[model samples]
Target: MTDVPRAVDRLDDLVSLDTGEIDRTIFSDQEIFDLEMKNIFGRAWLFLCHDTQIPKRGDFFEAPMGSDNVLVVRQRDGSIRAFLNTCSHRGNAVCRAEEGNVRNFMCTYHGWTFGLDGELVGVPGKSIFYKDKLDLSKHPLRKVAQLDTYRGFVFATFDETAPPLEDYLGATGRLGLDMIAERGDMEAVPGVQKFTVHTNWKFTVDNVFDYYHPQITHMSAFSVGLIPAPPDDFVEGGAKSDTGANLEVPFLPTDLHNFVVVGEYGHAISGPDQESLEVTAGTEPFAWRHKPEVEARLGRHGGRVAGHPHIFPSTWVTTNAQLSLRVPRSPDVTEIWWFSFRDRNSSADEQAASLDSQIHFFGPAGMLEQEDGENWAQSTLQTKGLKSREIPQLLKMGLGTSEVVKEDGLAFMDAPINEHAQLWTYHAWREWLRNPSWEELRERTIPRDRY
Candidate 1:
């Protein structure tokens, strides 16, 4: 781990946190939330729409970064660039459409226009309005500090000093995106499903790692066969209601395993091993990259990672052809966007079927997200209470017991479904809130044998 002054002083309080347990205050504190906007969202390489969404010049899409929004455009030179959507002239939004093809953006208020590359291209009466003295170049849209793509997923950052996209992503983060990229000839499914949840953004992020919640939160999905449900006699810790009994219930199948890849700059990936066929029940639906030699490539270690993978701050890559972005709006509100994709090799019917399942599982009408959102919303409300803010959250499941196996940039733990990944994220979050130098941030969060 890197030595970081900004975060080190708060280490004890931060690490003391138990997985699945948290002080309600974190969800509603204005100061903490504001710091998160700067330390986490400001510096992270947040996912924008896929390159396919803006394949032609003049095509653009609007994406959120914390409370701010950016316009990602396809340039005439066959490249992509992004800039803040706010106008350089008077802070008015320069573009209002969610996505469309346009030669230039004309601000509704003052008619200021900007080119695809965010260059100021036209003003209604440039010479007459400003005596030809105003420099359009100087007032061009404020370009994002960095923009990059991996396997077609575009991303941008606001911090000029942030590390290059690849370095910041690390192997863990790369693997997360690669999971979707490895699927055959993938592309975004066209429309992005947007919905708002009355909860803190972090709830959506941490929930991705929560295998423990599905049975309870998404019982509807389980009952309807959207997800496989355990038999009546099955139990995790035990059949008893006590924590010790529940701890002994044996929730996960003995063979099911999890791969947790903790990386530099607070990026991490947590999921079931992909190579394992048990997850697919022998369906083998996805055409994973290097399938001809994936077993050889991943070896015995990586052959089984088949669970959800999350990029720090706001991106989630699921085993199915889907990606989701959790955009923070305010301390108690979050906007989630879903990008569903399909294997280009599949027939039209298969693609449609796949999309149907995706919609039923995660979108606005999805069974799973609704249940999860309720708890999140309620949790956020609890945080607003003064007394609730002082109580500590807990993440003790599978703690102090499981030995983490570290290999090939991934941190492995054989423990049954637990809160290790969620706990690790909060620890990383605290590090970011301290706002250390990039070098220190990286140093403090490098991969380790155990975390």
Candidate 2:
């Protein structure tokens, strides 16, 4: 017999992350991915479309929850609800359209129909076909375990045991959202930009926080001037001649500092000082940190966090103002969806310009993402081999050098961009795979501010 551990114990191996390295099997193993779907995606609060997308009664948007899908609908009373799209009678999807306004849904299989609230209201044959034996009132649509919205962004969870949405987001995740929300009267653009990539989902997640690859991986972007050339005075901290000699790259000014925030449930944020964006960018059109209120609300961490802020398991929020969801379709195939938002008060032209920036930065056609995806695809493929999978992936940037500090339910690192947040995320991942009670999970993952 194979000496396989229980699913819980196996998760430990999958999440075996230390300061300097992580196991390769986590990216290529089917068994480990299956457990992740159950213990992680199944229980955690997954981001859905914003409430504004379905403002009127009967409007709905379709969202994926792990392998399953759900319909996010707005009710007549203005509240929103989400339920599985599958029909209760025969398991066929009751709704087929990606999104639309509908008073009711009818399954094409048996003509089983349901009301806006997902209550069964019609059966094609009824008394004629079933002699009225069907208990219509007994089964309603399978509602999600919980659904909630904060700052106009909707999220849903599948486990009834999961913590409340706000509690789960904690401070770190909230800061990430706050960076976007404080932008203005912001709402999700009417439609999402969806695309697929043949790479492990973990690659997409890790890349969100990776600050080291830009100069080389995106050298083409720099060459083509998609991202502006560095200023004459820009200098990288301890950057080598090979890494820095290429151009007068506008280095993060000497005053720019990296601030990392680690929150409960594996969520975290990292960035350069909030004011750095304003002071360094000067009059650059792409600069987004000039607003005093945003800098103040973001506080010290916001000022220093130029790196991406991540809500663990799948959501990534960027300093340039974009949100990405990394959907795991399989062990080696993942879907990346981009949502671009702009202040409704901004002029239409301004909105278009903001969206243009988002598209160029990380969408399917994004210059930087194209390069990153290539590496991720090759990495996953190589890891499938016995010898290759045995080799460890490194995360050693600023490893033992990280000095963690704690405050207001967040653990932070004061040093220049370090891997502390990434390490913290893995630690929480191991605790979550064990499937502890919500209270225990919170206790185990809560930050102590120091490592």
The CA root-mean-square deviation of candidate 1, after full C-alpha superposition on the true structure, stands at: 4.4
TM-score versus the correct structure, for each prediction: 0.90, 0.91
RMSD of each: 4.4, 3.2
Per-residue lDDT of 1-451 in model 1, one digit per residue for the tens?
9864433354445444434455556778677778888888888889988998898989999999887899999899999999999988889999889999999888888889888878889887889978999988899999989999988999899999888898888777887787777666888898999999999998898888877676567667766788875644444643666444455334444344566656666566665555443443445454454476655655455555677778888898877789999888889999899999877788999899989989988879888888888999988887787787677766776675666676676666765666777877777777788788988887766645544
lDDT of 2 by residue, 259-341 (tens): 77888888987655554444544446434555787668767555456667899889999766788988999999999888888
Candidate 1: stretches off by over 4 Å: 1-21, 231-233, 236-256, 274-280, 286-290, 293-300
- Position 442, candidate 2: lDDT: 85
Candidate lDDT scores, in order, read 0.77, 0.79
RMSD of 2: 3.2
Would you give me the overall lDDT of model 1?
A: 0.77
